[model samples]
Target chain A: MEKKYVIGIDLGGTKISGALATVEGDIISQYTVPTKASEGELPVLGRIIETIEKVLEEGKAVVEEVKSIGIGSPGPLDTKTGVIITTPNLPFKNFKLVQPIVEKFGIPTYLDNDANAAAIGEYVFGAGKGTENMVFITVSTGIGGGAIINGKAFRGSTSNALEVGHMTLEQDGPICGCGNHGCAEALASGTAIGKRAKEAVTQGLKTSLANYENPGSYEVFQEAAKGDDVAKEILDKALTYLGICVGNVITSFDPEMVIIGGGVSQGGAVVFDKVKEVVKERCFETLAENCKIVPAGLGTDAGVKGAVALAILESK
Target chain B: MEKKYVIGIDLGGTKISGALATVEGDIISQYTVPTKASEGELPVLGRIIETIEKVLEEGKAVVEEVKSIGIGSPGPLDTKTGVIITTPNLPFKNFKLVQPIVEKFGIPTYLDNDANAAAIGEYVFGAGKGTENMVFITVSTGIGGGAIINGKAFRGSTSNALEVGHMTLEQDGPICGCGNHGCAEALASGTAIGKRAKEAVTQGLKTSLANYENPGSYEVFQEAAKGDDVAKEILDKALTYLGICVGNVITSFDPEMVIIGGGVSQGGAVVFDKVKEVVKERCFETLAENCKIVPAGLGTDAGVKGAVALAILESK
Candidate 1:
C-alpha cells in the first residue's frame, strides 16, 4: 500500500500528544495523555505508545500505511543514536527511545530535541516557510533556539548548535542556571522575569506585584498594562535583555528571519518592539534592515505539528 | 587541455597578492603588487588583471589549464553579484570586480570577503582541514569571522553571517567603532587593547609603557611578560573579555573547532590560555570540553591560499 500517513509524538514532561496525519500535514486524528513522568521510564514509555495507538485507531490507519514516526522530546539527548540521554523533566536516561518504537511499528523513526523540531516545523509549515535560513527561539521558563541553515537543520558537531540562550550577553551580569554569569536565559527568560518580580516584592518595594500570590511574566504583563510602574520597569528591563539576545543572534547568524515563540513572546507588541529596536542598535544596518523578526506563526497546537514537521522533513 | 591550475588573488588595501596553483592546492607561482587604490577603481582593477596574467605566465599555464579564478577582498561586497558595494581599505563602490576578469580570462571567477575566504582556506587546507563544522575568527584591528557548516561556506541570507565580533558582551561597556557599546571588538580586539594602553599612558599612569613613543598590544604583551603591573592588568582584562567572546561563540555555534587567526592571536600562550579559561567558565562543560579552540594553522601566506581555497571550493 502507498504510505500516506505519519505519526508525530510531542513528548513533554507533563503530557504526551500524538497525531496521525497525511504526508501533506493534514491531521486526521490526534490524542493526548498525562505523562506521569515520576512513574519512571517504562510507564511513561507505555503511555507514549498508548498515545500512538489511540491516534492510529481514531484515524483508522495501519502501521504499513504510516511513512514514519517522529518524536520531539526534551533533550541533552543524542539525536544521532536516537537516545534520550538525560533531561530534567523526563525519566529517560540514555534510553533507546527510537529503537523500540521503530521495532514495534516496523517503520523508520526519527527523534530530535523539541527546539530543533519546532524550528523545522516553522521552516516547513509556519512563519519561516520558504526561507532557507531562519532561527526559532522559545522564551519560556528558559530560553532555547534552533537554526535552519541552507534549508536543513544545523545540528553542529554534537547536535547542539544554536544554544543561543546560554550565550553570554553581559560579562558580569546575573548567574545563570548553567553556572555561568550573564547568560541570555538568566537575564531575559520568563523564569528570569518572574524571579526578578519576586525579588522586588520580597524587598518590600512599592508595587502592585505584591498583590499577587506569585507574579510570573503573565501577571507582570497584566500589571504593566494596567499602569503599574514596578511592573512596567521590570518588563522594560527583561525585554531589553531579550532584545539584546535577539540582536546578538542577528549579528551572529544573519538569517533571513527570526521567529520568536513561547510564553514570554505572548507579551505582544512590547516584546517585539524592544527586540527590534535593540537589534537595529546592535547589528549592522544592512542586516538589521533586511532581516525580519516576528512572532511564531504556529499557535497553541504547535507541539504536535512541530513533531509532524520533524517527521515530514527528515523523511524527505 | 586538462584543467590543472587555478588563480587566487588576495586584494588588500596596501597590496594585492596573486597565486597560480594546481587543483590540489599546490602553489606553482606567485606575485605581489601595490594596490594603488587612490588612483581610482579602474587602475586597481587593471592591477588585479595584470597580477593574474603574471601568475599564469610564471606558472607556464594557459587559460585552458585553469579551472577558475578567485578574488578575496575587504567588504561589504556582494558575493552573489560579484560587486564590491564599498570597503574602507579598497576604493570600490558598487564596482563589478569579477566581470572583467572573467571576460579577460574566459574562465569562471568567484569573489568573497576575506574572512570567509580564510575560513574556506582553513577548512580545505589548514587546521580545520578535516572539520565538517568549524568557525574561523580573525581578531585584529577589529574582530571578524566566518563559518564552515557541513563543509561548505555557510554565508546567510545576505552573504554576511558569522559577524561574531559585534555580539554584545557588555550592556554598558565601551563604545565600538560601529557606534555600539560593549561589542567584543570594542572590549577585546588588538585595537581595543592598544587603545586602553594608550589612554593609560596618556593619563600619566606609572608604567614602562609611558617610556615608549606609542604603545600597542604587542608592547603590552612584552611589558606584561616582564611583569609590568599596568600592562599585566590591561592584558588580564582584555583577555578576559576575549575569552567571554570566544565562550559566547562556543555557546552559540557549538562547532567542532574554533580557529583564531589575525594579529592579536599571535600573543601566544597568554592569549590562548585566557581564551580557553574564559570559554570553560562561561560555556557548557560538554561543549567547552568537546570543541577545540586553537590558533590558526595557515601563516603569512594565508591570504593567497585563502583566495585559492575560495576558488577551488566554489568551483566544485
Candidate 2:
C-alpha cells in the first residue's frame, strides 16, 4: 500500500519554503521561492503557490498520495478561523490563506502560527518526542514560543497563546516593539543585542565591533567570542535576560522539557551553556533540577515540517 | 454502597484547616486549629492530627473509610518524595509529614505546596473547572501561583513549578527576599503595597494614612477608596505592578483563564476591576482578548479542598 503524504509551507518575509512529507513527518522533497513582500500579499502568496507546485511536481509520487496541506506563518492569527490577522513581518492584514489554499488544492488545509507549528514539529519529531508536556522557544530577531500539552499544541482560548517574548523581565528597562517596558524580547532579542552594542559604541566604549559600520547581534557574538569586552558585556546581558525568561517559563508552565531554536541560538554551546547556568541559579532548585533545556533538533526545517505535521494530525 | 472519604489538611502560619470530604469532593465535616507556628513543628503536627481526628469524628466516618490524607503547606517542598524541605511561614525543615500520616492511617498520604493544592482545587471544583489548562494566582502578603495542565497539577520536572511571584517584572526596581531585583512579589505583593505606603509616609507625603502609626495594605486600600491622595498614589503604583505581572502571565503561559485569590483579592470588585482593566490594556491585544481574569471561587476553603482534590486523584 502507498503511504499518504502532506504538503507543508512556511511563509516568511523574504522567502517561502514548501515541502512534501510523509504522514510520519519525514521530508520527501522541499523547495523554496523568494517572497517579494514589498509587492504585497497577492504576489508573495503567488510565489508561495509556485513553490508548493514546484515541490509537488518534484515529489510526484508523494503528491499523488498527498492528503492535505498546512501553512505556518508569523502571527497574530486566528488558527480556528484560519486567518492571518496581522503578521509583523508580512505586508498583510487579515489575510484569509486557508480557504484559498484549500480551494486551490481541492484538499483540506490548516494554518498555524510559525512558533506554534515549530513547537508541534519539535514535539512530534524533535527533542520533545517523549515528553507529555513541553514548551518550545525560538530566539531569533524576536523571541517567540509555543506550548504542547498531552502531545497537542495548546493554543489557549484563541490561537494567540504563548507570546513568550513579551513577558516583562524588567518593568523600567528597554521598550519593546509590542510597546511594553522591560520585556524579555526587549532585553534579550537579537535586535536588543544589536541595539546595546550600538549604544556602547556611541557611548565611547572601546570595542573591535567599531570595525562594522553597522554591527548586528551576530557580529557582536562573534566579537565577544574573540574576547572583546563590550561585546562580552552585551552577550552577558542578553544571556541573563534569556535565563530569566527560561526560569519564568519553568516557574509558569512546569513542562518536562524546554526546546529552544532560532537565529541567535546558532551561537550553539555559548548560548545554551549560559542559559542553563542562569536558569539553574535563579529558579527554585527543584524546578531547576528537573527541567532540561535542550536545543531544537530540526533547525531551519522545523517550521515547514511542523506545518506538515499539523496537516497530518488535522487530516486524521 | 458507602463512598470512600479523604482527609485534607491546610497548614498555614496562623491556622490549621482540616476537612473530611467524599472522593467526589463533597465536604462532610471540617475543623480548624491554631497553627501557632512560632511554637515549632512538633506541636503544630500534633494540632494538625487533632484537627483531622476531630473532623473525622464529626463526620461520623471511621478511619477505614478514608482512602488517604493530603497536606497542603507553604514551601519549598518535595511533592514527589513527600517532604517539607522548608516553609518560611511554618518553622519546619526537612519535615516528613506524609510518612507519619500514612503510618497513623495505614493509607497513602500526599503532600503539596499550598499554592499547588489551591490550583488543583480551583481546577477541579472552583474557577478553573472543565479547563485542561489554567493558572491560579493568589495575591496575598506575597504572590503565589500554580499551573494545571491536562487535569493534573503541573509540578514541573521537580514539583516546584509555578513560582509566579519570583518572575521579574522590574529588573532594577526593588529588592526581593529571593535576592532578586524587581521580582513581581517585590513590586506588587501585599507586602510591597504596605512597604510602599510606609515609605510614602516616611517621605512626608501628605495623607490620611498618617492616622495609623503602622498601616497595612488593607488600611491603604481603605484609605484609597475613601479618597486619600497618598493612598491612591500608592495603590495605583501597586496596581501597575500587578497589571504588568498579569500581562507577564498571559504572555508566558497563555492559559485560557487566570484565577486570582488571596486576601488582597477580597477587596471585592475594586482589585479585580482595576487588574482586569490594566492587564487588558498592557497585554498583547490578541492574548488579552482570549484570556479571562476571574476571581477565585472557592474562597478561603481553596487550600484544604484542593488537598482533598489531590488526594482523590492520587488515590484513584
Candidate 3:
C-alpha cells in the first residue's frame, strides 16, 4: 500500500503557513507567505492558496497523494460548513473557506478555530499526547485555548468549544476586547499584563517599567525578574487571574492534562510554575491531583501540526 | 431481544433512594431507606443493598432479569474501582461499594459520583435530552455538578470530573468546603446566600429578613421578590455569581445545554430568569446564543434517574 499525505494550513493575520505531512503526522515539507491582511480578504486568500501550492511543489507531492487539506484560523468560524463567521483581525465575514480550498485542490478540506487546531496538535504530538482528555491553553497577547475531549476536539453544536479566555472572573472588572467586563482575557492575558503595567505607569507608581514608552509583556516579565516591585506585582496579579482560569478549566472540563502554550507562556517556568501553584491551590483536590499542567511540546509548529492532526482525524 | 432492566441507587447523606427502571429509562418502581450513615460502613452498605432489593421486589422483578446495578454517591469515591474514598458526610473510608452489589447479585455494578450520574440522567432523559453535550449544575445548600460529553458522563482519569462548584470566582473570597477561598460554592451556593443574609442581619441592616431568627436562601428569595432591599441585594449578588459560573461553563465546555437543578433553582423562573440574564450578558458573543440555560427536567428524580442512567450507559 502506498503512503498517504495531507496538507495543513495555519492562516493567521501576519502570515500563512502550510505543511505537507504523512498520515502519521511527520512533516515532509513546509512553506509560508506574508499575509498583508490590511490588503483585505482576496489578497489573504491568494497568499493562503500560494502557500499551499508552494508546500505541495516543494514536497514533490500531488493532490492524489493528499487525502485532505485543513486550515486553522483565528475565528468564530463554522467548522462544519468551513465558513469564517467573523474574525478579530481578518477582513472577512461569512467567507467560504473550505469550498474554495476544496475546489482549488479537488481534495476535501476542513477548517476549525486556530486554538482548536493547536489543541489537536498538542493532543496528538505535544504535551497532551496519550491523554484522553486535554485542555491546551495559550496565554499569549490574549488568553485563548481549546479542549480535547474523549481524544477529539470537542466542537459544540455550532463548532465552537473551548472559548476559555472570555469567561468572567470579576463581575465589575475591566472591559474586554469582546466588550465584556472581567473576562479572563481582559484580566490575565499578556495584553492584560501590558495594560496593567501601563496603568501602573499612568498612576505614577514609581516603577522601573516607566523607563520605556510602552512595555510589552516580555518587558514586564523581564522587569519582574529584575525585582522591579511594580512590574512584579503586575505579573503576579496577571498570573493569579490566569491561574483562576486554569482552575475553572480543571473543574469545567476535567481534562487529564492542561498544556500551556503561546508567547506569554514562553516566559517558561516563571509563569508555568506560578500558574500551576495557583491552580493546585484553587482547584478541587480530587481532580487537581489527577491533572498534569505542562508546557506545550510543539511550540511554533503547533498551529501547522494541529491543522495536520485535524485533517487526519476528521477526514474519516 | 428480551426486555432488560437495571437498578439505580442514590446514596445520599440521609437516605438511600433506589429505582428499578427499564432499559429505556422508564421507572417501574422506587424505594427509599434512611441511611443513618453514622452507623458506619457495614450498616450503610446493608441499607443500600436492602433498598435495591426492595426496589426490585416492589417492581415485581427478579434478579435474573436485572442487567446491572449503578450507584451514585456523594464522593471523593473511586468510580473506576467502585470504592468510596471517604466522603465528607459518610463514615466510610476506602470502602468497596461496587464489589458488594456485584457479589450479592452476580451482576455487573457501576459506581459514579452523584453529580455525574445526575448529569447523565439529565442528558439521557431530562432537560438535556437530544443534546450531545450538556452540563448539569445543582446550586443548593452546596453547589455541585457533572458534565456529559458525546452522550456519556465525562469522568476524568480518576472518575472525578465536573467539580464545577469548586472553581474559584474570587481569589480572596470566603473559604469553601473544599478549603479553598472564593470557589463558586463559597460565593454563590444556597449556603453562601444564607450566609450573606445572616451577615447582613447581624450588621443590623434594616430589612424584613431580620424578622426570621435565621433567614435561609429560600427566605431571601421570597423577600427579594417582595421588594425587600437587603434581601434583594443578597439574592441578586448570589445569582450574579451563579450567572458568572454559568457563563464560565458555557465558554469552557461550550455545551449545547446547561441544566440547573437543586432547591435554589426550584425557586422556579425567578432564579433561572435572573441567572440566564446574567449569563447572556457575560458569555462569549459566538457561544451565548447557541447554549440554552434551562432548568433540569428530572426534578427530585434526577439523582435516582441519573444513577439509572449510569447503570444503563456504563454497563455497555
Question: By DockQ, who's the top model here?
Answer: 1
Best model per lDDT: 1
Each prediction's RMSD over C-alphas, in Å, is 1.2, 3.8, 1.9
Off by over 4 Å in 3: A1-3, A38-43, B1-3
Per-residue lDDT of candidate 2, residues A1-316 (tens digit): 3548888898887888889888888888899888778898777778877877888788875344678888989898888888899877788998888877777867678899999999988888888888877999999889999988766777876676678898877767788998877888989999999999889888888999898898889999999999999999899989889988988888777678999999888888999999998887676666777788999989657778888877876677
TM-score of model number 1: 0.98
What is the CAPRI rating of model 2's predicted complex?
Answer: medium
Candidate 1: give the clashing pairs: none
What DockQ does each prediction reach against the true complex? 0.83, 0.54, 0.72
Query: Among the candidates, what TM-score does chain A have in each?
Result: 0.97, 0.93, 0.95
What is the per-residue lDDT of model 1 for residues B73-158, given as tens digits with 9 covering 90 to 100? 98888899899999987767898999988888899999999999999999989999989889999999999999998888988889
lDDT tens digits by residue: candidate 2, B19-109 = 9998889999999988898887688878988988999899999888888888889988888788899877777889888877777778678
Ranking according to TM-score, highest score first: 1, 3, 2
Q: Candidate 3, B257: how far from true, in Å?
A: 1.3
Show the lowest summed lDDT stretch of 10 residues, model 2 chain B: B149-158
> Which 10 consecutive residues of model 1 chain A have the lowest summed lDDT?
A88-97
The clash tally of candidate 1 reads 0
